[model samples]
Target: MKLTPLEIKQQTFEKGLRGYDVADVQAFLTLVSNEFEHLLNKNKELEHEIEKLTDRVKHYERVEEALHETLQTAKESVEQKMDGAKQEAKSTLQKAEMEADAIIKEANHQRQQIRQSILRLLDRREEIINGISSYLDNAKKSVNQFSKDDMGTFKLPKEEDLEESIDKVTSKSSYSRFELDEEDLEISSYEEEDSAFAPGSDRLDDILDEID
Candidate 1:
């Protein structure tokens, strides 16, 4: 059977007439018991150390798993943010294009307004020139009626006032210098007042209404 330390100590051998020395047998047993006790203590210390190392390994594995999960989550979050940023960029670009188109359309409308104003100025200038021509023709036919004093009293017209007044002339149909029949170049001048003026006075209010 197996011998423990206490059982080894209790073991006794029957003495033979000269088989073994008494002191030698007892000394050998004592040595064996001491060695066994030392080995048992050493084995227990080694087992405890191994368990501590195994626990440390398990703890490290848990920490590594947590860190990996965190890294994966961070990567996913970054990807989502990038996706949102891309969509926002696209939306911003679309808004910018729409704004640019709106600005261009408004500018085109303003340009058309300017072109119409220029055309009106040209038509008014033509009418004023035609009226002046008719006046000159009438004056030539009634040259006897005009005295030298009357001629001297006639003022040299102010350039700014004459151009501005021509732009306001309402009788453009009655006094058009433009010839649809045959285009030609000619300059003319006219008196500000005449008897052939039809209805009431050509008031400033009427001119303002035509501009509107």
Candidate 2:
């Protein structure tokens, strides 16, 4: 059987005539038990320390694993966020380009509309100018016709009579002593009457100048 310190201390050898000295044996057993007990206590203490160190090492390993996982997760999250931001920026840029194209197209359409309106206005202006020109031409024809009628009513000199009057006035006149017969005076009166009405002859010419 196993022996404890107490058992070793209490153990007795049977008495014999010449076995061993009793006091020396008991003292030696006592000494051996004390030393063995001290060794056992030291071993237990070392085992406890080893257990604590093992637990600490496991804790550190767990912490390291958790930190690695967290770092990996953070890196993945950052990449995902960057990808999302890039896609969003691309989408926004495309939308802005489309809007810009639409705005340009609308501007071009509006410009075309304005050009068309200007063309229409120019056509209207041309029509107005043509209408006014036609009206003025008709008015000139009417005025010329009226003036011819008035001349006919006034019984103005014929071409032959006017030529005869010019010959008479120009014939043999002395620059220093000019004189006139009854015929010459009569012709001179007719010419004065013609001169009095001469201002009305240029109405058609004035109307033509305005049209030009």
Candidate 3:
């Protein structure tokens, strides 16, 4: 049984012949009971302080875990955004390369067309030159065929036959340089005629016979 300080002070033993001193024991017990109550109250206060410190420690641990989780989430978001930027840059580079290649191909095609046109122009110029050369040759042959005899020698005009005829024709108007040279050659050949007609009037008549 627990003893109160008041109960310990109240209890006293009577001392008769040869009995121990009971009053002194009761007073000492009262003092010891009061000291024990004081010690128990102080121990209870220390236990409450320890419990509160433990709760604070638990709260701090949970906060540290939440901070770590938030840091990891932020790092993951940054990495994902960087990867998307790299992909977009790669696609843009590829598109630029394609555009450059298309431009080169178009330039090559235009160069080929220009080369073909130049070749065609050269070929057409050659054809025109050949046609003009043929026409000049034919015109030279026609000039060789002109004859004083085909026009017929003048009948009974004078002794100097071809010169007199050319003079009469030119008196109307002047003839070209070719006709003037022909008349000069015929006037030089007046001695070649014996009967009434000459065998060869001049080299002009000879040239006319060769042409016919």
Candidate 4:
């Protein structure tokens, strides 16, 4: 049913009255077959080239898809790493803040303790100073009373009597200028020998020694 180039070249026409010239018709048929065969070969070449181009396009599409997937995976991995780093940093920061707060609290507590100790020391010093001041005031009052009593009751002997009394008692015994009451006279005479005792000098010394 289909006519190839070879079939067209080999075709023949039946002889009849007023029929075309056989040689001319055969020559034309040969020329048409050759031209058609050339056209067919060119179409086949074009089809082969189109098939090669199509295969290349499919390969390029596969490569592009693979690149897209790789990029997406890389982006996700980067985001995950960044999030992890952020969380670690936040945790570290919180820990540092807590530690700092604890240190500050401890320091404040120590400072309060030190302050309390200083206040207690100051109070104790004040108490000691007050006790000493009260003792000294009482001692001063006792010394003043003793001086007034001595001035009122005691008298100095004459220079001639004093020299004679000193010579008389030099080898026998010592004497006190003070005349004590009957209850204290014996003890005072035995304990005290200095007739030149000043008003508050020896008495003040005794009181200070007692205090000590």
Full-model lDDT for every candidate: 0.72, 0.80, 0.68, 0.79
Please identify which of the two predictions, 1 or 4, would achieve the higher lDDT against the true structure.
Answer: 4
Write model 1 residue lDDT over 34-131, tens digit each, in one string: 78777777888999998999999999999999999999999999999999999999999999999999999999999999999999998986766565
Backbone clash pairs for candidate 4 read none
By the TM-score metric, which is better: model 1 or model 4?
A: 1
Q: By TM-score, is 3 or 4 better?
A: 4
Maximum-TM-score candidate: 1
- Best candidate, lDDT: 2
User: For every model shown, what is its TM-score relative to the native structure?
Assistant: 0.53, 0.46, 0.37, 0.51
lDDT of 2 by residue, 10-102 (tens): 889998999889999999989988977887788889999999999999999999999999999999999999999999999999999999999
Candidate 4 residues 53-139, lDDT tens each? Answer: 999999999999999999999999999999999999999999999999999999999999999999997887676566556656766
Candidate 3 backbone collisions, by pair:
none
lDDT, model 4, position 194: 38
TM-score ranking, best first: 1, 4, 2, 3
Residue ranges of candidate 2 with Cα displaced over 4 Å: 1-36, 125-212
Better of 1 and 3 by TM-score: 1
